[model samples]
Target: MTTGTHSTTAAGVARPGGPGPLADRTVSRVGYGAMQLERVREGRAAAVALVRRAVELGVDHIDTAQFYGDSLSNEVLREALRPEDGVVVVSKVGATPDPGGPRPMRSAQRPEELRASVEDNLKSLGVDCVPVVNLRRMDTGPGLRPEGDQVVALDDQLAVMTAMRDEGKIGAIGLSSVSAEVLRRALPAGIACVQNSYSLVAREDEEILALCAEQGVAWVPYFPLGSAFPGFPKVTDEPAVLAAAQSLGLSPSQVGLAWLLHHSPNVLLIPGTADAGHLEANVAAGAVAFDDATLAALDAVPSRSQDVPLG
Candidate 1:
């Protein structure tokens, strides 16, 4: 659609404010995730262009990690972004890339490791301070879990993160892959947002989502349409989702993303894609609307959780 402050649906309903407060800045709910940029086969030039296109479409919040292709994603952002662009780059820490190890990434959850990760992000992004840095806890995961010395205490991690925030190394603190109890305990630290694996079909973290909503913390779901990993259910594969997509003249993926936007006001999406068309569609998904009947039908679809092995 239009690159305005707010996006409107076909039904004429406006997305109030179009952007919400995160890390002391109001950012579009439809943001870009930079992980895919690490794997873009077209190479760095195309990846940079995709990032620029995202900014052109009014995306202000970009989520990334230093370990994503060993800081390659952040480097792409470094080449593509400028201070005048006014984009808030959010990064995560908790793991580091291991090219030769058994896994692609390994837990870096020690307090010192966390600090090094933040430093890596700052250096790679060429920023003095990260707008937001999410502390990706390995307590619960669809990915790597801490072991041996990697297992760090939450309070210890938060202490360092808060110190960084006070030192102006990071503007705000967020969390990922944490349980409701962990979030509840961490609420006093001023969590700006939470990145969790949640979707129309995989909503195991609904409690955590509700807690974030109640506490005014933005809920940024990682897999808004499920994962490609086996055992995980894709929202597009749901019959009701397909039917709704057909009736609305939108892709099943769009329908899935739209359902998340409509699910809660505090929910911010960071759907990732390397293709130009998919990038546009993900941003446009913010404006998709649904009638009450369709919304209810989509809502009625049973939520399922599958334990998929992840590194």
Candidate 2:
């Protein structure tokens, strides 16, 4: 059951995160992330059902990558959605699955490799053109790093990405895990959105977030509730956060996610989960409104840099 009692009408009033822009489409600010679908223990059918349930709950933006679960995420999306559903399907490149390697993924950052990855996503998702494709640059990482020839130039990668957009293989281009300078350079390519690690506590990417805001690009944060990584602090663990949650009659996670929404108007969330109940709570986070005192308390929770990678 969802913890939020807020409801939405046909106009999308009071809906999760309300509606925001992504590329050429206006989508629910509280969108779904399909990466965790790869680990659903309930089988593919259950995964499909969860996606459908999200759609039913007013989710229209979905963030995914071809490297996730070796394209299993795309396959599940293919089975669960149709183009007419009007959902904006977003994907990323710059890496591919490497099941037997030390890491579950390896760099495929070359221009040609990115093109191939886009083609693979097209085939797997059964779509002629993906709405948005984020070029996940390995500049600074809490994840895989590019090596040798795999370290491709941003302009070189953008050339092919722009070409694909011109060819209609991708509707728009986005960037992920990038620095402010890179985003500034790529702005000429017409960036539509950015996916970076940010949260109430993890604020190392504030410069990048500010740049995106200035450029009118959507800020889709990946780890909105911090991460499971050792050095990363969970937002729920903060005493102030716990106190706020209790006062509001909501969970700590809801308060954490709501803070992002309140922090920035352009911020969009792609909080992922396989459990049906958890999905409801995440969506309900959209309804979370804060008083000035609560907001001040959360704002004073002390920002820290998440130095460790989220992988």
Candidate 3:
């Protein structure tokens, strides 16, 4: 497999900009997912600039959620792209949180409310239709309910999403924050993508990743760079990865992402960063190619150095 190929988009990234399953959608296989754009102590100014620069540097896909800051992220996204065109904007619903203060979360799928819920997302995004509507599946929780009743006992949130696909409110469907069992619940629906916690430190998803590859479904692995995992194996500290990086003259993070690009063509990397330098470094990783010897060494590295669970 080859690596280190990013297309230039003077206007913005267009789907199918490269090759493989992502080619049909204009969303680059190595596209940037925008969940990390949320403001911490700083406001949206820096994040907004980073996103705009991502477009300038040719990242075709930008994934987001209505629940991120109660649609405030979408608003910031809208403001940032006041100039570019032809970018694929993917967003999700299922959890809506308070944007102001005293943060609280709520689900908007009550069967009766499913239709309205999608409409709110369209309005919030300022787009007629979302390129993708990932059903934020939370099949486990207290006081948390699904849209339908006793009809489908398992993963009721999925039932509502399947109905909406038939109703035509969603274009292409996806799933997020799902378990292997919960993900299996969505398999019959022909979902376009699945975002789960998986990285060098979280190898529990290796099975799921292989399954997605066999099914020809896009696997958008989130937190691939050890997102706060207990005893997270520092990608920089990994002996083999460090040696490979030294050989290739790249950063450890870049080498980690390059390994992910090597994981499978179905794997779409969405490593997030608030800093511009970090963003460029992440993008450069897509260009780093590993030789057969380096790949074999990397393959020998255990998927999870620690038995830590995915976050």
For each candidate in turn, give its C-alpha RMSD to the true structure in angstroms.
3.5, 3.4, 4.6
Per-residue C-alpha lDDT of model 2 across residues 1-311, encoded as one tens digit per residue: 12233234233434577767788777788989999997789899999999988887877788898989999999999999866667889999999999999888998999999999999999999999999999999675367667799988999999999999999999999999888889999999999999988899888888888888888899999888986577668999999899999999999999999999999888999999988888999999988889999999999988787654444
Q: Model 1: per-residue lDDT, tens digit, 164-251? A: 9999999999999888889999999999999988899988788888888888899999988987676778999999999999999999
TM-score of candidate 2 versus the correct structure, residues matched by position: 0.94
For model 3, which pairs clash?
4-287, 15-26, 15-27, 16-23, 16-26
Error of 2 at 40 (Å): 1.6
- Give the higher-TM-score candidate: 2 or 3: 2
| Candidate 1 error regions (>4 Å) | 1-17, 307-309
Can you give the TM-score per candidate against the true fold? 0.94, 0.94, 0.80
Better of 1 and 3 by TM-score: 1
After TM-score superposition, the amount by which residue 297's alpha carbon in candidate 3 deviates from its true location, in angstroms, is 1.8
